[model samples]
Target: MAWDPAVYSAFAQPRLRPALDLMARIEPADAARVVDLGCGTGNVTRLLKERWAAADVVGVDSSPEMLATARGDGGGVRYLQADAAAWAENGGAVDILFSNAALHWLGDHRTLFPRLLGRVRPGGVLAVQMPHNHYAASHAVMAEAAAAGPWSEVLSPLAARFPVGEPSFYYDLLAGGSSHLDIWETEYLHVLEGDNPVVAWTRGTALRPLMDAVDGAWATGFLAEYARRIQAAYPPRPDGRTLFPFRRLFMVARKG
Candidate 1:
């Protein structure tokens, strides 16, 4: 199934607040050619253009459907459907390589970081942000519950590929590099409203692969169990909002 921009936008938009905040830290004067890797629906790319109006901004993603929805007249931002990892490897140099909440999908940051760092021009910046919630009960319980079910034969193998790691892991990769690097982690307490906010959040990002892997019955069952586990782990407050503490890793590195 193609990615429905409408459904995704409603949930993903709020989660992207931290990424936009990180973008604000970049020097506008230093932004001439900006590239947004894994630019889902081009939302962040548009913001980058707004922040640096003089810059030529481009958005790149592996999903054509997401890239198609990214089309807009506003930012003069060009959207391209391409593999970010390959683009970085081919030396698609830019003044700033910005990625928001998308790096975790590519996996193997140790290698991906070096490739991305190489694409940045000397003195240019490479900024990235990704969610670090694989170990959280929301994700962990999904695998545990699935492995105990009849679908365990198939789901168990897929669960092993969950892409999540510690912030310190990325910090170590950028450390001692030829460039200056700043790496940190932040937990955003997003007060989301809705009876199934956790489900809404996963549908936009983390649940895609799972949805693609199973039929409707299995998927529905999986989501139901996952939601129950998530709600128990992250109870909703009296005000009808959940304190969804999303932990994210950020790195801003400038090549020397």
Candidate 2:
């Protein structure tokens, strides 16, 4: 799915809040080098640079468009294009391998986690945060719409890939490599305004796959069906704001 920095950054503060929460949990230590994997538009990467001013922070991303915006200004931080799944090859041993809302776009965590952990030094940290809202209504309704609508025949396979696994899945997966593991989930109730805020939210992320696979007209029809379902699933408050509850998973592991 193609990412739109403008669309993704629409609710900038709400998105940035999760990255800040994850950053707060990171133990303070001497980090000579840090990397922001899948660093979209380098917003959080800039934050990482601030938190570790002494460290050589590199914001790594695959999208040229995001990197273009990222390179515009990030203090002295270096922004470059690289495959997120193979990010470790570009840089040597890193003290901190940080990724926010990016790793899920790659393949499975079963092998991905272990490979990523190998890039960290013996005492280094691997920090990640990914959307666990695939189980939420915003996603479910889109899958439902895709399966039942006129586009079902063509869009069914697009729903096959689910990038996120539950918290338990990670705890067990990383038990051997991590000495001090911090794993948790947060459900953020974002108060949003305007019509079908949920639809607007997912358009930047979840709904992109289907939209990418179809033409403008079919995509419009599919979005209409999706928006209708989501609107019903999430109603507006008296003040005309819709409360969108989004779930995300975070984990910090120190290499043993």
Itemize residue pairs with steric clashes in candidate 2.
none
Residue-wise C-alpha lDDT for candidate 2, range 124-205, written one tens digit per residue = 9999999988878887888888897778988877765678998998998776999899999999999999998888888887
**Minimal lDDT window, size 10, model 2:** 84-93
Question: How far off is residue 55 in model 1, in Å?
Answer: 2.1
Which sections of candidate 2 miss by over 4 Å? none
TM-score of each model, paired residue for residue: 0.91, 0.96
Question: Which has the greatest TM-score?
Answer: 2
Write candidate 1's Cα lDDT for 116-182 as tens digits: 8888888888898888777666577667756766667767676666575676777677665646777
RMSD of every candidate to native, in Å, equals 2.0, 1.3
